[model samples]
Target: MKKKIRIYQSINTKIVLVIVLLLVFVLQLIGANFITQIENQLITSFQEDRKVQMDFLESTITSSLEIEESGEGSETSPEQEISSLLTEFSGSGITDLQVVNSELIVMGTSDTTQQSTVGQLSDDVDLRQAQITENSITRQVIDSITQNRRWKIVEPVFSSGEDSQFLGAILMESNIESVYDQISQITWIFLQSSAVAIILSLVLANMLSRALTKPIKEMQLQTREIAEGDYSGTLKVYGEDELGQLASLINDLSDDVAEAQESIDAERRRLDSVLTHMTDGVLATDRRGKIIIINEMAQSMLDIDQETATEKNLLSILDVEDDVTLRSILEKQDDILVNSRQNDIPIILRASFSLIQRESGFISGLVCVLHDVTEQERIEEERKQFVSNVSHELRTPLTSMRSYIEALADGAWQDPDLAPRFLEVTQNETDRMIRMIQDLLQLSRIDSGKSMLNLEIVDLTEMLDHVLNRFDMMIHSAEYEDKKYQINKEILEQSIFVEVDPDRMIQVLDNIMNNAIKYSPDGGTISGKMEKREDTVLISVRDEGMGIPKADINKIFSRFYRVDRARSRAMGGSGLGLAISKEVVEQHGGHIWADSTEGKGTTFYLSLPYFPYEEEEWE
Candidate 1:
């Protein structure tokens, strides 16, 4: 990764560069103005000095000319007298001097190099202009050959009289190199001063930039730390400035964010706890129906691992049809029944959907609550079957009674034997229906927890003997004489006492014995055994006959359930005997179960807790 530049360094660099550039520009502008002013002043002074020198030279030459003209005995010529004065003035900073007459001829010269050209016409423009205009003229020029700057001044010399005729012009040229040299020296000094100022400005700018950007850089670092979830450090307030205020605000913001995060984390933990411990499965999806969150129950219910389920499309995992998307369910606010299977056992889940929406009324995602309703649905189906079975059972006996009564009503009573047989059949069917109804009422009472056992300590051995003897007497009678049913008893010799309602216990024992007799073949042995265990007395009834199938053994104790429904109904069995027996056993703090094998006999086992009989209580 490329390294990041620090904010302070960048800010500092830019600030310093801008300040330095501004300083350099302003300083240079001042320096240029100052130099130009100095050069102009120096040139103006040099021109004035040249004009003064020329005026004095012109006055002296005219004085000499007038004095010589007035003196009859004067020997000096006008040109020689003027040349003597010009020579004196040329030595005083003048580079060249010349005297011109009215005819624009060079009358006298102070330059030795040009002395041979005396009496030559003056080719100087200013001198010719002075002669023509009769006015003094001054101009400055640079010498082409020497490349020296010079100023030229020309003045007309007049006669010393009232008429004052213009005699000639005096022209003088002086070098101004010294003034240029001074101006150059001053410009160099200004440049040096400007360089020093710029250097000082740069140093100060760097320091100032540091001062300005140091706090801002600290704030930047603090903000970055805050972003990474650290709100421990605070920036030092350097001054009561905008940056300082900003730093304070950032610190405040950090505190607020930390507090908000803590609250959010706490809420998240609470939600997680609820999801973890909830019995129902909960699933959350995104707007696109991708799974975002799935709790443990959801994972277990869907038989999916978290790693495989997360971020996968919800519809794909659910294997729902196209029309049953999470969004559609949420929008319709409907509960869906999802049918699935685990371990080949059908599972039914009732899933209620709720929409997750934003504050702006936009749907963001969905939440589904899944409840396992398999057991409930099975119970509902069983209840329906029970009602149907009850109706069928009642309808059969009623139909038989109705047919027999109708036959009697249709004059069967006139045939005495037929009418009597028909009447007997009706009476038997009525009794069977009455028995069936009584059994149904008893079962209803047991289910509603309204049947209470009257507890009494009694010898279980005597109870078993009493039930067996009742069957034995029935077998000995003429009704069962052709089919031999034998009772074999294996009673515990030691008396085992138990606390139970004697009537209910007898009812249970009778039901078991009757069932054994009903399923046993002719001459099959029905065995009864009473064994005392460590904590309870075990009473079991066994039959040697065609045994219950393995698959029907578990459901034999259910109400209206029969191993052979047709045979059971033909034998006047209500199919609730074992069910009632079980309820009675359980109500007495005992349990009953069956052990059966195909092609072998089935043993119905009843366990009752032993009671230590006190003599007084037994009495």
Candidate 2:
């Protein structure tokens, strides 16, 4: 029977049933309480009315007894007065009025059979209140005769107010059965009305329940469709209640999810575009080392077809070069993008993955990406080779000059008088070649980013002084050197020291000064000066040279590049001074540039950031 019921089959029906049951239970409880109260009131009202009637009879009987004692009419006994009182008691809604004497005799009654019962005495009558009260009492009394039938009331009559005298008790009983019958009829009407009300409530409840559940049922079906991966369309809802609002939200959510999915699909396609046509290879892996996805490029790099690569472990498929930077990136963190090349073909690749967590944040899967860099590597290699070739070209001349100076020093300078003259000339030429070779080497290392600078504080004034002493005799002679630099003022004691690589910077300054001397027409004024700016120091070396043409200023720093090669070689120039100077200044985190105009002087200015080295290291 329980199995046949299908309790969960109809939600609306069940809810309606529950509502109707609860409403009916409460309504019935109220009706029962109402009926019980009304019945009690009816009984009390009927008994109270009967008590008044009995009191009237008692008063009349007591007055009559007084009259009898005074001899006003025919003097009657107590029993006779009671019997007359009972006989006179009359009302249509009442019946079976009777009276009894103190002796418990049936003196008289409205009906003869009831009078006979009166003589027997009513044991059910609550006589205690009457006995306690001087006047009258009223209460419900169960029928003394039939047991089921009820009576109204009875009252005892006293002889007089002053004297201790006994008078008969006047019992006036009314059936009140008709009032009870009327109440029964009304109760039947109430029951009928309650039945109608219950039926109506159940019907309304069922309708309400259906109205509530209809949209919910539709939404439930739609949700199942969504769960089953149906993104076809959306559900439309009616009305403006809570369920309608819920439907609107679901519709919006579905649209957003669909749009988001399309966007994701678009991104995947874009990624595929880059991966499929690229020359180099790419491979991706999951947290468990399984291949989650791979671009065609990656598949090609590993030398495996896509069909064969799916579900394979990444570590197994990848043919990564032993010393590639990608190995460090991949081994460092769990799921960040790392780059690597699988073979010597020089493929640049990026891989990214994540712990694919569910809503509860449990790790589930991983993802990765790839790229190619063979062309890039080739270009970089060409640049390095070009720089190396330039360095070798500059070194050969310096090497030849050094060998001549060595041979001249070994035997040619041994004759005492010729020694001083030959040694000085040889020393000057050797120094010039040594200076050129050292400048070329520095330029090569700086361009390759292979040189490390000693970032320390050095006195700029003292360094300049030491270099100045080497040229003191030339500056003082002024005849053969033909150049004289005048100290304009007392050189400022630059306690304003800067963080610099002094040796590298000296090489830079010396190159610029040599070029100035080499290119300047005879008897030209040359100048050197230093000034501090907001965050850097500027050193300027200027000469009134045969000024550069406008178009050629940009190319002056190109290697093995010279303006008027014959004139530069005649002045013992290596054509690498300005080029090397640029490299050294840039390596010191500084800038060097030339400003020249037609027939005007050229100024090479070098600027370096004022690095404060004395402050404590934050690291």
Candidate 3:
């Protein structure tokens, strides 16, 4: 949005104001000097005119005094002649004129009000000063009664002789206020003319200001539009001047800015797309280690929302502050493991760090990429354990076989009793090793998805009966005479048909039955139950034997796991039966689990998905 400019703040208004101010200042200075010179000239001319008039009147009075001395007085006395001369010479400017004789007495006066003092001795200070100095003296004073300005001039007259004698003096009072009034009138006229000139200057200044600011105002508007991301408008160029060139430059700048903005927008969108789709979590932090950028994957890995994650310290988010500091990570630039559990699920992440540095080798921030490695790390650990278990399992039997073979080679074979027993023990150890290897290979195939099931439709009732009958046959035989056991079968009378690989299913049953028989006491009963449910057929083998502990029950199906390692080994068990059964059952789209009472018994159940089908259709 374009901001509104105040009238007082506008460039146009400022230009107008500056011009008017400068004109006023110049006029003030000129007027002061002009008025001063005019006042001085007027005062000087007024004084000079007064002096010339006073000198002429003094000479005429001196002539009157000489006539009286020569005894030529006829129609008028010397004093009357002097007074007449003074009255004749006194013009518009003269207020009063008086003639005093050499005795300091006023002989005659033009002022009627002062006629009484004309015959008396004149005590005027100017007249006394004129008599003493024997020269003309003048002083200006104000009238006490009228408060009017007056110029006083006293001229001493001398007798015409080789030694000039002071005869009398002529005193004149001139009203000089008219000279100041004229000067004031001229000053008023000058002020009127100056005001007219100032008004004209104001109008001219306004026009010039508008002309100077028009282009600038247009440019300002266009620039404001450009700032608002509207680059379509261009400034009008009035002439080939600085303003015109500037307008052209602005148009070019707008184009450049628009292109740069588009490019930046495109790059930003591309970055967002890449960050959204990336598999690994990405995080970026500023130099202070506060998170500035975090992708969705990073948010998920950290179990944080964007609002919570932004500006949070990187170490705090990763929860590795106790182990490492930001400086350590930056200096090492190494990968670290983050182990966190959210919602009771363990999450393991491998975070790799890199520096977000400038070309000048200044490090600005750090970038961390997190790849989830939970499943991979678990597999790696299981692989190592599997290898160690296999090594130990094979080594035990191999060592036993080697021991017996060496005994026979050292002439123990010659002893009839020792030879048979040692050979039998060696043979048993060899068979155990062979069985363990076969089970390992079977598990490997199942895990690799190479063991395809030979599926067939079989009646689950008959399948359970078949497995039970085999165990029953084993129990009845002389080989199991010492360890007597009973097999109890609880099969659904109605034939329950299921889709399965018959051989694998039999193997699974064999594993459960053998475990039950091995753990049960000599007179223990092994109960096998089968039930037809809505969507699955469940088979459980219950053994009257010491049950698995609660803690180890979940791990009973793991490879190479045994509750009693010494007893299992002594019983010629490879410890892979349950693990193999679990894998096969899962491959067949089934689940296997166990339930046990610590001192009473354990039940192993296998459930396979089942759909109700017509028996006739399967036949």
Off by over 4 Å in 2: 1-26, 29-37, 64-81, 88-96, 102-106, 114-137, 160-164, 176-181, 240-245, 264-619
Q: Between prediction 2 and prediction 3, which has the larger TM-score? A: 3
- Give me the runs in candidate 1 sitting further than 4 Å from their true place: 1-213, 228-233, 262-279, 294-313, 316-323, 339-347, 611-619
Candidate 1 lDDT, tens digit per residue, 1-619?
Answer: 2359875549898999899889888888888888888889888988887777766776778866565445544577777877887777767678888887767778778889999878888788887788778887776788999898887777888897899987787777887888888988998888888889888988999999999989988888888888787988878887678988888898899899999989998999999999999999998989888889999998888888888989587778777766585546766978878887655677998888888999999989888888999999999998998999899988998999899899899899999789989989898888988888899899989989898878887878988988898898998899998999999989877777877899999999999988998888998999999888778889999998788888888899898899888999988898889989989999988999999876778899999888566679767
TM-score of each: 0.66, 0.41, 0.80
Residue-wise C-alpha lDDT for candidate 3, range 582-607, written one tens digit per residue: 99899888999999998799999999
Model number with the top TM-score: 3
Winner on TM-score (1 vs 2): 1
lDDT of each: 0.85, 0.66, 0.87
**All candidates in order of lDDT, best leading:** 3, 1, 2
lDDT of 1 at 279: 96
What order do candidates take by TM-score, descending?
3, 1, 2
lDDT minimum window of 10 residues, candidate 1: 65-74
